[model samples]
Target: MEVAMRKKIRRIITILGTTAMIFTVTACGNRMDTMQPAASYVADFFDIPDTVTGIERLLLKDDMAYLCCLEEDGTSYLAAMDIDDGKFLKQNLDLDASVSLLDFGFAPDNSNWAVCLEKAGGYSLRKFDNSGSQVQSVDLAGVMDSPVISAVGRDLFLSIDMEGNICVAAKGGNTLVYLFDNNGRFLFSLDYEGNLMTTTTTAEGKIGICATSSDRMNYDLLTVDMETQDWSKDKICLGATAGLYGGVNKDFYRFDSSVLYGYAAGAQEGIPVFNWSDMGLGTSEVQLGECTDGRFVVLTASSNQTEVLSYEMAVLTEGVDERELLSMVSLTATPGLVQAVSDFNKTNDRYKVELTEYFPYAQNVSNEEWDNAILNLNTRIISGDMPDILDMSNLSVQIYQSKGLLEDLYPYMENDPEIRTEDYFENVFEAISLDGKLPYLTDGVAISTMLAGADVVDGNNGWTIQDLEKVLDTYGANSINNLSGASFLKIMLQTDGSFIDWNLGKCSFDSPEFVKMLEFAGKIQESSQDGCGGTEMSDTYAEAYEEVLSV
Candidate 1:
């Protein structure tokens, strides 16, 4: 059997003004390290209002940037600025208790900008002219229960196609998108059972909104007839864009509903290849300024500052010597971690880390389902289709090490100047080390602490079993029943005796000391099972006994 050696590398890429980088990887060969800037427009900087505390929504139309900025007093104002010179033309419309700005765009050949504001279980479709004057306002009150429905105006899109002026705003949480005309007339709505990713126009000049199912796999473009308000669905040949948290791309050039359409190299091509590769050069929910003379502006804002990035769309559409390869990385997905990975990828184009999923629907999975997914992934690893990163937080590092699947990372850490052992939290190296060999690397450390109602024991520096027993006695018999299964296990481990001998991978649960721990567990179980001390259990002893036995 041939053992394949996998190299895990960590490299930092500097991003400043359209930097293009390349990294070549192949089996049994030298990896070329090259860095070059691409032929894209350089980034331009601008300053927003010093009092501007937060950005509620952003939109760009006809070379002008529209921003809904929240002031330090929590008041939102609609502001407009020139994309070319970053000059604030005008603003003063105050909108309070605003939830989200749904859709913002221009009417067909109209200079006025229409925006939908969500607030207090209602939808306010307001139109503002170039000078920020409110010309029209329509309120759809009682759309949802305010307290119950926290997220309003989650997705807002307006498209003016050959069909008619159409507006799409999320009515419910991943449930529906209400449609309307340019005059704030409620046309119709489509029952969309997914999170809206983006809105694009079909080549035939039709309006379409791209959405992903709850599983984040189904990418469906829901189109609506602007004339008749009729809705239709066509499945696009691409995996769902990583919602708002995940950076998404625009699909601007596809007309035929029968043909597969995807964004490749900044152009819509007839390809259905599901590229889970991350270019890192992308955006979340951003405002695209008017495209004029083959160039466009990207406006992005945070709480304190705003930035404008100019780009030559034509240059982007054309091929450059640099290539952005999508590097696939598999990890247990969480919002914070996903955003972190997204930010890291955007830092440099040399390597884009795309996260692969063990299952199509990773969220809201049962423990049994998660176990099965891991089992399936382990089988894949056995067949040599291992992911670049294992994300051992969700899997057993010991099992991988025992199977000779995990490589020792100590040498890599030692040789890499970027990584320093002293920078990590105490005991991390010892905890992740197996047989004097490091097998796992965690992004961060989790500190464990105990919460007690009124201290009864000296547990500050750590206490012994006798100290714990005194604490329990002080709290009385009811405390034992309140202890969860995990708490019971922790106490036993902290008290004394080892469950497993790491070298032999064998547990010593049958030993006399282990029996004492089991007896303590039984005492608590009996109290709860017998309905003593105001505690009750269906089958406490059986459940508790099985928990210990499994360990």
Candidate 2:
């Protein structure tokens, strides 16, 4: 509030943690100077909850994270955690029969979870609530006919061989498909994964599933329509490999509005395992910073330690490492909610939504609400009203500049480079060359950012950390304005920057692990390429460990 109070609080914080000492010095008409703070300014973090156990996967909705974990006594449990506070709110459970959890079924309200019993040699998929109350289940004895089980909306779906069947049953252990309404009343089965299960709706209303089959590949690429289910093939695998249909043909890294993204893997060479796009479905995909979607996409690489893909603008599109991004939302729920699916779906279309409902990233809001927002925006746009949601990313800002939404900084920079350098916008600023002229206007990525994330000032090629560090020190040290000195320090301290850059489209490989594997693979490559005219293929490789006989 007051200057003295602010200074006192800053001093106390410095004593507690690493606080940068910021000294302001003003010169007449020359420029302002700020003394660099030696320490970093990491936000004071609060204590997190300790009750969580076996939280292997979490799907955050609004502020709640629907979590699944193996409990203390070797039982599977689904619980809700408050993301902000890390508080364990509640859990939903159905049958506690087997010791292993196979899958969690999808419904409008909550979900159904499947537990497999090997002794029985099959699974009994049950609808359970957050409290572990069982609402319904399939009898394992007879369910052997169709072992594969998946949930679409409120209906239970089963796949025997290549075909899909719908199942619904009351509070009993029985195997059935195509239940009448939400009750266990058997209506009919389909020759394929339920007809409604595929091509049933858009990315909104009905869920769409695409399942393609391949006899060669060990796994399949099961495309879950972000909406409901449009279509799904039985043996489809991602990053395409040859199969029954001609050959794998699709861009491994592609994104459209309806499709949003697709991967036809069998494209390109040396870049076979190239991680790309934000909506990736791989285990190694990096977190592309954090999203409002609650779950963060880990960046296989980062620049300036702040935003992802912070390297200079180039044709080489930085790829995101898609590890945590492949998460499914609302894994499990109470069986009562599953049991009540019939009335709920019929009662209100609003209640029937996708698995990840209302998540911030791919938020599943009511079409009515979404349409209302869109319409309101249109009305405002036509009526000369300002924008409501204004979070346009760095790339979007470039477009905004073209549209004349940004202020031209040419005069300011030209008048006084010393004074102008003090107030750089958020994130990295990309300087655009105007008609092959001198340093012109620049576009900022954030309120403030490092120069490494920005374009090259010297040679104008390659993202060199040395150049970046130098520019940041200049900006961070000399500017009276807020300098993102903390970003550089944080990245250096918290991460392996060299490894990060390798993954950030610099090294031209998936990761250092992949690179090391390739280097190791070079030794074996000679032997493996005997068919490729290697002449003499070496079959041996260096090993760090040798397990000898027991002495």
Candidate 3:
């Protein structure tokens, strides 16, 4: 039945919506005086077909763009496009039910290609040598139970390192990666814990698998040693796999969120040495074009269209020069804070900081009205509308950190003569460190502790959040009324399950721990028949909310 379905779907069917962009990076010599445009148009008004309801997967290989789409009738189609001239190629296939393209990569011989297709409950390997013809096909249903098949998404990934070996990563059963040669022969499979985000090859013949967890809270970069079948894993501090782009050189350059991380790709120990950092705030959330000759193009999506941006990047050998005049810009919703900075600017001659008010709508608006205002602020920041030295209160540290936007302040603190790290409390300092390095500065600290009645919960005895939950689970809904919002929030803050990490700049507020906190709070609200009987704490927290709650 499966082979019949595959034959039935593998026809010359072009089911619409195919678009492509060809991006090339250019290397330029230093004149530094000529202004460089951050981005420019490679192509415009280019899009998929009108009939295509949704895009299931997008892949770029050998300057060609392949997209899998699902029609309104629940059927799937694979479309190909020429990235150079926005030309639609003559290859489209109707995919069987529950079958979709996972990933595609160049075969070892460079003359053929392989595509990973997921069927109802299995996978298949398809080879195309004519660029429009499938030369061979094989079913992977039995192998789908292997640990390498345990991925979390419908999309699979195929990549080749410098040595021309192939890597296929999938995410449904258990996020696993399989190694192979150019001949469609399986090498071996390895158990990978996270969603396969990207695969990189070093200057040598090393394959790097970059994967992340479902919640975007954990990440791993693994390198496989083929001959010995040895693999090593490196934990990535960045939380989400979103907005990550990079290519290999002498090292692998990864652009995550807003920062560029240079990982020494040739390490045998699997841990890539952090070489350099790029503070290109302008590159935030922009999809990188192909890396060529030290220049690259970026595509940014807005509204219903795509905008292109170009850049001239310096490679590892480029020299640097110090600037005389330093200018910084910031966007903020707080007027008083802006005015304070303006006052300082008036007195200082060495530096001039310009502040732009982000949300005028935030003024004279209720708390409910500020929701969209905050979203707007986030959109602007991600679009490279950033100011140096941003205030974190209005911005998301996790989002920025995941993008490599926020600078690690530990090095800065060490160099500054006047700033003493010891001045801050230990826990407060630790709170701001994600990977054990200070990425941001906090003005003060907020503490969370439990507040429960002697009759409601057992002896305090330094009861943790887990203990409180266990007690609640043992009792009925009546116990929830005794807990307040402040108390619940405090418990989350104190709990190890609070997934927000400032250093990494990622937060899983929707994590199980946070959900439990909200569920408890919801029970309290739900049990209040009149919604007026629950005790509410509404006073200025002079000392600490945790201290007050505990008392």
Best by TM-score: 1
If both were scored by TM-score, which would come out higher, candidate 1 or candidate 2? 1
Q: Which runs in model 2 stand beyond 4 Å of their true positions?
A: 1-62, 71-74, 89-94, 97-99, 109-121, 129-132, 146-181, 185-551
Which candidate would rank higher by TM-score, 1 or 3?
A: 1
lDDT of 2 by residue, 331-367 (tens): 1111112212212322342323111211122122344
lDDT of 3 by residue, 246-278 (tens): 453435545433223444554322222121111
lDDT per model, in order? 0.46, 0.29, 0.46
lDDT of 1 by residue, 96-122 (tens): 446444445555645444455555546
Give TM per candidate: 0.61, 0.29, 0.44
- Count residue pairs with overlapping backbones in model 3: 25
Superposition error at 545 for model 1 (Å): 20
Candidate 2 global TM-score: 0.29
How many residue-pair clashes does candidate 1 contain?
1
